[model samples]
Target: MRTKGMQRSIEDFSRALEQGYAAVYRRNFVSVTYEYMGGYIEEITGYAPEELTPEMWDSLVLHVEQKGELSGLSKEECFRMNRSGQVDRWQADMQIRTRSGQTRWVSDMSTVLRDESGDCFGTLGVLQDITERKDAEKKMADLAETLCLRNREIEADLALAREVQHALVSGQLKQFPLDVMNEKVRANFSHRYIPASTLAGDFFEILPLSEHEVGIFFCDVIGHGVRAALLTTFLRGLIEELVPQGDDPGALLGKINRSLKEVFGQSDSLLFATACYLVLDVSTGMIQFSNAGHPAPLCLQPANQVVAKLESPDQTPEPALGIVEGYAYTTQKYCLTAGEALLLYTDGVFEAYDANNEIYGEERLMAFIKQHLDLASELLMDELLHDVRCFSTSEDFEDDVCLLAVVPTAVA
Candidate 1:
């Protein structure tokens, strides 16, 4: 493997550089003429030294992966380099598929020879076997490509699944009833829902309990992604089936929970869900709501827009549904005057994180509500979501978020 520099004798240099086989290529007009190709010709290209120029080119070019550029030497340029006293030895790698259909990589080094009058005579070259190295290199390249392709396919499939989930998993189901039921013109409502990913574990819906009453329900499953999304879909159907009990928020949640336990309670995965349901009698300014392992809603006054956290009354304390079947859920009542409003939300809002890893905790949420209480429901919602977006480090949240604000119509 020793390499010789100019200081070495020509004999020593030749010995050092000699590798596998030698060949003499003569320039004959427009064609390459191989005057002498030694022992390695058959081993390397399955062609004899006496092979015709056109025949050799046709055979070798067939094996060359890049047929457009099969030449190893530019005879004219080599002669020019030699005449100019420049380093005339040239080295290159070639990709060839042998007659046996096996890929081979070989290194070639050639130097131009000159006649006494400084005219180009021919060229001498040595070809070395580098097939093992080439095979290793190709394998590495192929491995990298395969990995990249697999990753892209998985991401694409997940993206498609996400789109389907968004269409079916949200509270937009059975909307015709919600639209026409919201006829009590003055009840202003605004809400925001953002899933940490393409699909969410959170669900929400507005139901018209009666001609004079409307109900809103917000629910959050334990985790996220496909599993949680599936659970939400199940909950959606449960909500529709339990609409008959919607007049009493507590009764409705209890009924939904019992069905959930029957369906998912036996599973190893934590299938429990936290929920808050509210029914508002628009004409009477009466609002009744129930909570199950969910956050309490905030009640805001009319004139000064004071904020108050309507805590779960100890008398009607109940754990979140699914965890305790047959458990009685106590419904709480709060009277909203003409100018008052209520704010409902999921934990995703308070649990939002900043770059510093700090949670946008409940205290911050309470403060935000208190600060924006005087603003109309829709405006306050916009500002709240904007603030949350800025506070979070990225659009990819770690959880699902849902926020809703409801205000009764003002006195005529």
Candidate 2:
């Protein structure tokens, strides 16, 4: 009486579950017969309990198999494994066609029933509808695939942009030798450019203006990546248009400032850049340079074993480009003796932080140059970059780093 009462209670609980059914099968590993079927069976299959025979169930599964929706171990294989005592339970998701000719997904879970002698007799099982869950998973998979393709396309475009920017900057080492004022002079140029990303805000150009004069321009835009890279290109166009004024550093920067101010005024965005331009005349070893809120260039004198910052006589600070509409920039004169070098760089060089969050400031850079005064322009640039990387916590810079070194030697 107690066992019968527990069985009745179990069936009552199973009937309370939605879209689910319970079944008891009697089989001998060759044929299957149902001893009990209840709880939403008709609602799930659209067939009365007596109408759902073994033949009818096989027909519905065959229809799903023809559509290539049935997957995993077949029912026959599961029965074989159970009869041999290799498996006590099995679960799989499968598709079936309802009486209304609509396909639905179901989760079939079964546990083997053992006879008195430990041989398999039948299975106690449950079937649950899972069509909505399967549909949601498919949609998520499709969205992931689409996003992966778009990310690849964006990476390819950024690579192309990096190549173009590298070509524009001419970051490679270059040398120019000339004869001026009855003296033989050699100008050796070397630089290191490291971008924080595929695109950079730092830019430099070496312009050979005359037989005796060479103009060097370096600038740091306000930010990094695509937006900053675009601004560099715009500045390049402006520089080309003003090449005639390159001989006068003050006049050249003043024109570029006005042009940038005019363009920025037409937009709602606030944008500006820091720049320095210098014209080196090998004939007299004189450099006329103008600054627009940029770090002053350093002069390295190997003969005197000294390193000093170059500054104008008045020592007044000028606003960055585009900051003041009618600001008049002025030129500062500095004489470079034989075996002297000039180091021009963006603020990134001195702004890098160490593990303690301390900046690698201008004083440290000047000290390092004074110690390595005997090294050539190319070797010095390489060593400087190595030292800065070593000082950083991650051994990498967070911003774009650009360094340009020019050494003029009077040849015998």
Candidate 3:
């Protein structure tokens, strides 16, 4: 006679049989028997329900293809668990090769069906296909690994570019941390250079044009980063070559424009650069400078206690170099009396934005210079950069910034 509890358990199993949420299997531990395999079994194992038994499970253990695969589970541990007294349930994720030669992943869950004395009897289990989820996880892991490797390569390349950029332009007298002076010219120079990114497009040089003459040149390529910096390298060599040989600043800039146009003519992309070139003859106190669509440099007259800006000629500001092939550039001259300083910089100086989006325009720059006239040339340059950085709301700059100062040492 069956008790009420046994009847209820049978009823529950009958309900499960009707629902059939996943493929189901049955086994008897003592007899080593497997039976009552549900209809959905063939979708998983590629075999009809009647063909699966304890022997098939045992045969799968010796299958040779599983080595080096990222499959989980040990057949020995599973067999031991089934025989243990304390274990009542089994849940695992497993991989298997189907009879038709395809591989699939499955999640298995089972409950023990014991006898009246609580001795091992058999198991009832359901398995669901999990191959899609597992495959997605694997592809995600591979993509993440590839992205990591690419980022490392980029960082290494930028590091090399930064070092090369420094080496290319450091020979000039204008880089930060060093005071460059010429006794014959009776002038001192100091500068600041900040790249908005890991690489920069801004470059400058102070080359000796002759025994009594020196040229201070600053160039800014149209954009920033590796491409712009590369052009600067080309400009660096060409300017170094041409500035010393020629005394005419405008004519030299014209030569640079032609060369750059020729180099970029065949390509679809547009490339050009703007430069401020100044040739100072210290012995004669004569300064000849050319502006190629660049901001006009400011003059600090300490003797009069006033600020003066080097105004562009009455004509429209000259187009940036490399934009107009036949554009005739004009060189302007100024006499630097004792006790005066000239300031040269890129547009980034005035274009800096504050929290309110107001630019630190020409007016503010002039004011900053006027307020700090007592500062030495180097200190003056530092103060300007500090002001710009502090005024901006963001910690990083949006564009490359370069500042160059040329002051007569005997300025009254």
Candidate 4:
């Protein structure tokens, strides 16, 4: 028969078992017998608690056995918990064989127990099936690794494209004859090339249209990236071949439109471009020009402080080159006055916007041109770029800006 106090303790212990606590072992004070072994710890090992005697537990403690045996604990780990009455978070790496022989990884954490007098008793642990968690973590790690590799590959491809653009620009300007322009032509030409993504949408050339008439063209392709770049390249090759025919500005534009329409076909996917072509007569200082849906070039004369737009006839501005087949064009001329400067540019220069979404429009651009009318061309381009950047207040530009300027040596 159990005493009232002993029976109460047993009942309390049994309740603790339901609340995740278990009686691992008991030590008898009277018989000097340390009867260490009890509770649901055997539930984890598939063995009855009484089957593991104190001597058997001791023997299991001395040898490192398989996790499937002896409640899935090694001797050294269990002994440490027994002596210290302090349980460490431990994991048993083992494959559990199910009824169908399926093996999986599982882990559990446990804590040691003690008697009322602080004597080492046994341990109480919580086991959780963690096969799913481990597998998920491994899958996530592999996915992250794959993403890193893809990002590196994308960066490398962009870097190669950037190098190619740099090489294209390295000797491009040097090909132009700067010596023919007057020394008094205080003007500058500076350009920025940024792909809408990985290729430029704008292309400019100052090449010989003929021996007496040198041609200069600035064109903006329909969109951006590899497609736009290829189209611009095609236009460049066409300009090199077609300019030698000595066609006037209007005829040159028509030829280009016909060529593009023929090459790309008149389909909706046909590439389009806005272009301004000028054929300069070095002998008479006359510039034959045409604008194919391009921005009007500005003529700035510091002598009179006059800024004028070379006006075009009020016809509905046609779509850029290559948009429509058989589209006719016309030529205009400007008598180059001594002491006058001309500015040719793409929309990117005046159309840049700020964080507030405000456009640095034509008004601001005219103001800037008037203020720097007397500066050297190169320095002028730099100053304008700096001012535009200040207005934008950011390093990121929405489009590539290009400036080409010409000035006469003598001020009239």
Candidate number achieving the greatest lDDT relative to the actual structure: 2
By TM-score rank, best first, the candidates go 2, 3, 1, 4
Q: What is the C-alpha lDDT of each candidate?
A: 0.69, 0.77, 0.75, 0.65
Show where candidate 2 strays beyond 4 Å. Answer: 1-7, 19-31, 34-50, 53-85, 97-102, 171-173, 177-186, 259-270, 410-412
State which candidate has the highest TM-score: 2
In model 3, the clashing pairs are 339-411, 339-412
Q: lDDT per residue, candidate 3, 245-354, as tens digits?
A: 65888888888888888888666778888898888876667889888888887888876878876655674688998888777788888888888888888877778888
RMSD values, in order shown: 6.7, 4.8, 6.0, 8.3
- lDDT tens digits, residues 1-412, model 2? 1267746764666666543443332333435555455546676678776677656765776322211222355667654575675677756666888999888776666677776788766666666776788678778889988989988988899899999888776743376643435645468787888898889999988877887788888899988998899889989889878877799998899999999988876778778889999998877789999999998889988889998877787677788998989889998898887777899999888788887999988888888888999998878888888888788856667888899988887522
The residue-level lDDT of candidate 1 at 13 comes to: 39
Candidate scoring better on TM-score of 3 and 4? 3
Predicted candidate 1 versus true structure: per-residue lDDT over 63-82, tens digit per residue = 22221122444545544553
- Candidate 3 is scored at a TM of 0.76
Task: Compute each candidate's TM-score over C-alphas.
Answer: 0.66, 0.81, 0.76, 0.65
Sort all candidates by lDDT, best to worst.
2, 3, 1, 4
What local lDDT score does residue 362 receive in model 4, on the 0 to 100 scale?
84
